[model samples]
Target: MQTASGDTQSRLPDTIVDESALDELLSRPSPALQSFIKTVSSPLVILGIGGKMGPSLAALALRAAQAADHPLEVIGVSRFKGDGARPWLEKHGVKTISCDLLDAEAVTRLPEAKDVIYLAGLKFGTAQNPSATWALNTLAPARVCERYSRSRIVALSTGNVYARNEVSRGGSIETDPLTPLGEYANAAVARERIFEFHSRRNGTSVALLRLFYAVELRYGVLVDIARKVHAGEPISLATGSFTCIWQRDANEMILSALALAASPPAVFNLCRPEIFSIRQVATRFGELMDRPPRFMAVETGLDLLGNPKKVCDALGQPPVTLETMLRWIAHWVTTGGRNLGKPTHFEVRDGNY
Candidate 1:
């Protein structure tokens, strides 16, 4: 990563806006970011921006554009462009373009760009469509990257790319061997391969963020666990160590990585400073909610992973603390957390990660 200096504030063109409000995007400056920074121009495109992380990511990009004094034309893509994500995006002035990304034709013909934040994925739990998941998560990005090789790409990957035991290897380095345990990880792995093929072929400067757990009140494992316990449901435990970061912190980490992409096809584990145990998480949630967290602890051997030392050393702050994360989920559940939602890949059972 480049030495992010105070001059970053000054060298920042008239377009630079105060990053105080956009904490997630401003927390760190990646090597790719500095490189992307020098070349900030309008017509920025965020593929699959109509989904989960799109709104926040787009907003942050605009802020970066504002700081640089370059007028940014942000395009957010998805199946349809209204209601679901429209409100959140419009609140930040991000433009939307509707297209069912999984349709190869639509994805193939999508406009090329300067910077593309690829965030679309079929990322729910086992209960989702496997083929659909494969197509959306890995295949689509691979295709999109091929079409837009000229654009700087930051494809979101998961820490799942690392095998379970590999995570405990003093921080699973990006080069660790293939050990994806489930369909989700398999898809992510395939996506990375696709990027590699195109990168070598077209010299695409792409960054694959092997993100770990990103927690927020409404999403992730903690929230699901909280809802189950609150509703008096029985939970099972899995055996594995895991890592987590605040959603905002992960976002900042990603933005930083974007600047550092040029140093080869880089993979940075996006997580918090602490590696947590399943027991600790369960206990924490129980304490905060003032409810007993019931569970049958068993070994699933899944990779309950954590430890984000790399990014912490390079960037500046830890995403979310264990205590704060628990508190946030607890408060959210009490306010109206709802059913465990449609069990995402992160629905917790017992003490497993």
Candidate 2:
């Protein structure tokens, strides 16, 4: 991949997006989703339906249920089903169960459903605590999938499983060989492999959505850059190109997978059609805020990224454009999104969960 000489400062072209565009993207379901909805014989159970992006996914599943004309008992599974999400799910009359999937008792209690969305996993910088990441992020799902291999499973994976950029031009693909650069991603790779192994042995249908960055109320990577620039701190960079998708549209793609998972062990790259360098993302924030970004350049490789191919084909389109989604985030930040709160990951130094 040839980059310009002043690559760090070479910003990608700008884009403008509107609310109508957002609505339109959310309206359609991916082919994979349609397949799951049309053919799966049971209700859909989505684990991690209570985490960062869970609320949006839960809402999408309910809407998909109504649109597909299928009887979907959409259940939200989380360790502590928070109240913030309850309002949205309750509005849709979505069901929820509070339990840690890691608990044998909890796994046993999960209601039988033909289509399952395994959304539960540890997210974020886990290089410091490899074991804990391996346990919750990798081991738990492996166990749960084994417990319910008969169900069609749409297990969540990460773009992190792919090799870091320099090798990936646009990004990674479904059959791309994996190189786990960090502990967090290694566990994630392990999680996906567990499903593959089980599916091979038990004939369970599975699809691994290799998710890249998905954004909603909170500041995603762009906002992270903005916050640093906003507060007048220097933004750090490691020459990397990444992809992001709006949560609303991204959720629709994942739910679509449950319906698409009728086949055994399918892997799809979940990301927007657009690819932008880390610096370009920062510049967008600067553009929206009408300020110049404060940034320092360096070379970086940990690109948990993708180019949306499988998702587009399966979900009927690519994830929302980077600029459109970033615009939404900029608006939220300007109006004060008010920190919706995030999960606490293990400290990098503490090799504990």
Off by over 4 Å in 1: 1-39, 64-70, 81-83, 125-128, 166-171, 299-302, 337-342, 347-353
Q: Estimate each model's TM-score.
A: 0.80, 0.81
Model 2, 298-352: lDDT tens per residue? Answer: 6365454587776676555543456665666676566665554552221122222
Off by over 4 Å in 2: 1-42, 67-69, 81-88, 124-129, 262-264, 299-302, 341-353
lDDT of 1 by residue, 37-130 (tens): 5464457777777655666667766666666556767888877545467766766688877887667787777776777777777666434567
Provide backbone clash counts, one per model.
32, 6
Candidate 1 weakest ten by summed lDDT: 10-19
**CA lDDT scores, all candidates in order:** 0.64, 0.65
